[model samples]
Target: MKFSLYVVAVPLALLGTVVPASASFAAGPAGADGGAGGTAPPVLRLTDGPADKAAVAVTRPSPDGSVATVPVGDARLTARGPSGGLVLAPARSPAGNGPGDLAQVHAGDVVAGPTTQDTPHGVLVKVAAVHANGDGSIAVDTVPATLADALGDAEVDATVPLTPGDLKAKPLTSGGKVTAGAGPQGRGVRLNVDVPVPDGVEPTEGHASALSASLDLSPEFLFSYERAHWYGVQPSRARIGMAADYQYGVKVHAKSSASYATGHKPLRIPAAEVNVDKTVWLGPVPIVLSLKVDYFYDVSADGTIAVDAEEHTDGRLEIGARYDAGEGWSALSGPEPVSTATPALITGSATAKGGVGSHAQVGLYGSVGVAADAEPYLKATATAQNTPQGASASWGLYAGLKVNGSFFARLDIFGTRVLDKDWELPPLRYEHKLAGSDV
Candidate 1:
């Protein structure tokens, strides 16, 4: 069946909401100038360049109202101006590929062109004004819809006025609508139009669509792993804040949240501390560093963190640094002590007591591992070094609790460990008490 289609720009009303409509490229007699018969072919002229000033004398005109030959020069033109600028958009190529010579120019876009340029090939008019829709999008109106509808056949020609009698129609055969399962390509089945083709006519237009379903997922486990391993995920922070340390480790942001740090023991409870260490390679070898922070319910959770807008929650602020050795000490030595394998980080560190500290016994840290019973958690063991004579080294135990939090943990307290010994070793500080160098 010859189902002809036409392409026309739909006027968008700035006084109301707008809905995007799809249009087909108007088709017509085989090999016609406009694809649509009895219409002048579209002309291409640079609206912003010297070529726009070139005039065409219509050297030759074809029977189809197409220019067989035309003049091409910058001097053979007249300089005319439109009231406002033009919005020029990149035109898609004929093959639907990419940018082409053709441009989509809206009436009121302030196009980049000097007012002194003009062409005598076609008629041009001055646009009264231009306006914005407030958004980054532009809205241009060439002719009022009311006036154009009233002018009818005079405003535009190819679109013939359809009389009431043109509404008569009869079913040629029958078409079927899909009432059941999805089609082969994961979409709803399509309905087939069974109308027969006319004797010398060909179908010039058609549309096919099928329903589709899509699923998006965010797995907790995967996000957890990615956050733990990837440092410097956001480079902008490093470029702005820590340009020097930026080379050592990319700046990383760490946040933990909960509806409420509640119950006898909520895993991420108020000021409950957790230590997670990973081994990364800046070059060929590995640099093992640990992130230990005791969080306080700090900033109110931003709505971006969750799907439900009304479910406002709270989050913890992290006060920690990406690590490099204090001053001495080998780069890595892994998560555990290389010489002792004691599962402790005996490294020089900088404490916020405001300066650098040497040989700080930070604490015992852990990696993500499941217990023998498949209980997923990080295993921890707190240890102390009592280097003074006759003192005893004490140790404690803790696990990086994920769901079940530290019940009694405070700002400085970690997990559920009770401070039994005075292991208050000063980030475990000591200045090598250098045997006899005047204490």
Candidate 2:
């Protein structure tokens, strides 16, 4: 399939204007001026009250296509309307007021939600709906507003299709018979092959058979997200996270059959193989990453008979990022193992009882600040006397991450393996086998 990867980075400085650390709610528009033809809006005054053990408010959409405010505890006031359509201003406590003063919400004001400290002495106001009077007075509406109301919602999903321009394929052997065709369902490219075999093929020592194909893929972009947050006195933190997943390698699909005359020698055939090398950019970032993929499939048979073997294998790499505020940069996460390789299947029957076997393997290697390696492999064998005998195979996929330079946070998911003086994660493995079968 065709797809593009996009990397996004957001800085905290552009989030929004900072407010007073002491005041949870920021100041609203100035009060209106009282003039000849101007009327003043109703005033909603709030006063500090005795601390209540339970005080909470929730803002949600109402069935009537309006927003609704629900409050619980000491004072319960419900308002309905669109959220954040109102405004709120800080309340001033009267002279000689103490910490235990009783909290009061006037007719024009409503408690949007509970405060972080859960104290009425310094009530936090989340204005839902309030009108601005010409005289600068804050007027209350039927709807309440809170921080949740002001933010709305944030969520997304995206996808990109694959095309032929994204893939390049070639034959491995000179003069090897190879043809490119449509992939399954017309989504990807499929390579077909038919190589020439030499006459008077010797026994197990030698026979003539050569056919293989390889492919290189354009860089693929995946997904990304950026966010900036400003905490009162704390340093503003700019966070950006992104991920990419792509596949490359040889022998993605191999199916073969061969026949030989009577002989005691067995023949081994390198059915298919490929190698790839490419450099890629980490979307929108200046960092450079390189990757390599290699694949090989082989089949062998001893005796005068016919043999059939087939193998389907693929490889994928997943890349992720983490921001290092201390270093003012982002580091990549270690690669993880994925189960996408199919088991190798080999079936054969010989006139003279002999043995047949096959092996397939794919290795994925990558380099960023550090080096990483992962391999998925399979093997199978079977024997036939005078009757027909078939054999199925099983395989395993594993990865190893080695640090060559500076140290970064370790991704615990990948097991650990120590090589030289560097620490590496043990490769992940996926296995599947047919019953009563040996590799």
Candidate 3:
């Protein structure tokens, strides 16, 4: 396994010309013109190839010919070119390239199936090159010329055989990867979606019910357009898209600063930077309030603002501050912006009772701003649970009252100050199709 982290930032001023070059750079053309754009190459990978004793074998070798096979450990793969794409040439093909360079491993030395299998007239050989996925996974590029001719009507029982796929050359796209050859553009309608607001702005009642109050600064939506013929056959070209989605804990965008609609120039931002600073109050109470800011633009476009906040936990990490990391989160009590977290992602609430003075909780904080001492006594508690993919967590007894208010508004003053005390609940329903699909 290889770990790589990098920050890439390109000003929109010169992005117009660099955008198209990014695609061409993968074609492996020699020269400064083919030098990659803002994208970074993958790190070199070294995996233990299979043993020679378990090496090549011809599934059905051609009756007459026999190709040589090298010992697994003897003939290993090594980086040879600046590009990360995989090659089938010898190790020192380029002689002396540094790390993250082009790599090569021969088919004959394959620890996989036999390098040359028996065929009717000649042997079926594993030659030529291939590309790998972002994670160094094999992607068959072309089938060997001899092997293709020997197979005739038969096929190689592989996920991606060179026989059926286009045998044309492909430009290496990444380390161990390439841009598969395909035809030109086909005529079809294209739908592009990009909401300027980092967090989508929901329409208010009539004009607006909940106005998103903030100096919105994130291009937080997706922009993809697929052009398929509405009448005849669908186009075979790959859909062109740019995903400036959220990362770490910040929302990334895709807007040319000068213009929201037209000047939507291209900008490539690699890794986001995080800055965190905290202030601890250790007087009669021991509590720490931290401030964190995510720098999207060069400077601090926003800061964490803490208000009268008090939190208590048995064992956890909690802070009160307004963070402007694109996910518009307001401070606990301080208000810099309204809630901008997306809708379907999360919905949580908690209620505890049994004579402990009942406590109901609701929060969409963290990304919000800071925590203030609240003039006097202050207490805090922090809790965090990282749920892995496909995991499920359920809470709530399906009974209780949920309300929020400041210290000034007494809870007793307002009834359950509960409405209808009825156990009946209305139908909970919502319908939203993936926006990418056309109406």
Candidate 4:
């Protein structure tokens, strides 16, 4: 199997254009013109055998065997007749130059399908030169709908024939030899053994052969032939091993940057990601669920020592079930996000997320609950910590449209409102692409 990853940094300015079901109709056509303001119609030219002519008023082909011609513009053509009627040819298109060029012309360009639903009568698409193989039949690449309509129905089928018979068959032979001593149930004893001729019986030189034993000899040699090196201590302790991984990435938005204007440099809070997954599955089901913790450091723009905060994360906890739907699949879920803070000095919020899925894909996920740390700690310090701070909860919805090459993107928008107030926040935006991968 092969894997690919890429990062697509779409400018926020252009997000509205491709955001799902969110674009406005007022953008209009990339480019369109008013009816009379549009460019004039293209010129039309026609020709017939042994004579070429130009005319504006032209007669288009009709379903019935009848003919009609009229003037369209200043030019005119001396009307000539074929065995059937004057077969006005199709127009040429830009992709190529030939009779077909016009035969498929639609909107001043060569097309393979009908460009318009309607056409006037007496219009005939011009055909290439007619060639007859001395025998009188002409070579043709395509047939007109009128001719095909007249021919009616034609039947086609594969020439190969099918043979019928019963598909089931018996095996060449019934069950053969079964190993008697194998696996955990058998103590690994060999059911068959090879024997070597006694040392003195090798005098005949005509034919010599050898047979080999299947089991290793080093450990068993002393226990069977020597028997003198036996001891009592068989290691009694079994070593156990464990492993884990955890992944976390979060974005924090600032309420406003205008408050802290002059002294400090603009703060850059790049997304924080922490991944920890722990597993201790020595044999079977009911493996111990692992817990992972993450932390983020956030600071207020104002140079206030009181607001430089740290997010002590309560890592996700996940437990996998034994049964599953397919290979590389598992039914598992994670614990919610929890934070550590003291009520006396800090006020913070936390969230929990968990779902069951396999690999890097999430089949189902949802929020379990929200919690805060240091609520009592904040109440005690409220008199001294006067930062005029507020907090509220908000969520966003997202839907992915299509995959483009290696980039997978989705459109999502969020709204925030101050609790118990009319203040509404502009929708928050987010987009992410797979950034990298390892072998």
Q: Whole-model Cα lDDT per candidate?
A: 0.17, 0.26, 0.18, 0.17
For 25-85, candidate 2 gives per-residue lDDT tens digits of: 2222235332333222112122222233122232332222122332222332222225423
Q: Which ten residues in a row have the lowest lDDT in candidate 3?
A: 1-10
Go through the candidates in order and give the C-alpha RMSD of each one to the true structure: 33.4, 23.0, 28.5, 34.9
Can you tell me which runs of candidate 3 are displaced by over 4 Å?
A: 1-70, 77-267, 272-439
Ranking by lDDT: 2, 3, 1, 4
Residue-wise lDDT of candidate 1 within 1-439, one digit each (tens)? 0000011221211121111111111111234342123332221211112222222111121222221211112212122326323332222222222222211222321111122224211222222344443432223333211111111111011111111221112222223222111212221111122222112222222312111111110000000000000121111011000000000000001121222111122113221222223222110111122223221111121111111000100111111112221221111110110010122221111110001000111221121111100011111122234565754433221211111111111211111122332212111111211111121
TM-score of each: 0.12, 0.28, 0.17, 0.14
Q: What is the alpha-carbon lDDT of model 1 when measured against the actual structure?
A: 0.17
lDDT of 3 by residue, 1-439 (tens): 0000001121212111111200111111223231224111111111122223112222221222212222112221222233322222222222221111223434332212221122111112343455654643333333433221111111011011111121222222221211121111111011111212322222222332111111111111011111112211211111110111111111211111121111221112111111111111110010111122111111011111111111210110111212122232222221111111221111122211110010111111111111111110111111223586654433211111111111111111111111222212121111122111121
Name the 10 consecutive residues with the lowest summed lDDT in model 4.
Answer: 217-226
Total backbone clashes of model 1?
7
Q: Candidate 2: misplaced stretches above 4 Å? A: 1-163, 166-219, 223-308, 313-376, 381-425, 435-439
Ranking by TM-score: 2, 3, 4, 1
Prediction 2 TM-score vs. true: 0.28
Shift of residue 328 alpha carbon in model 4, Å: 14
lDDT of 4 at 278: 17
lDDT of 3 at 233: 21
**Model 2 / residue 259 / CA error / Å:** 22
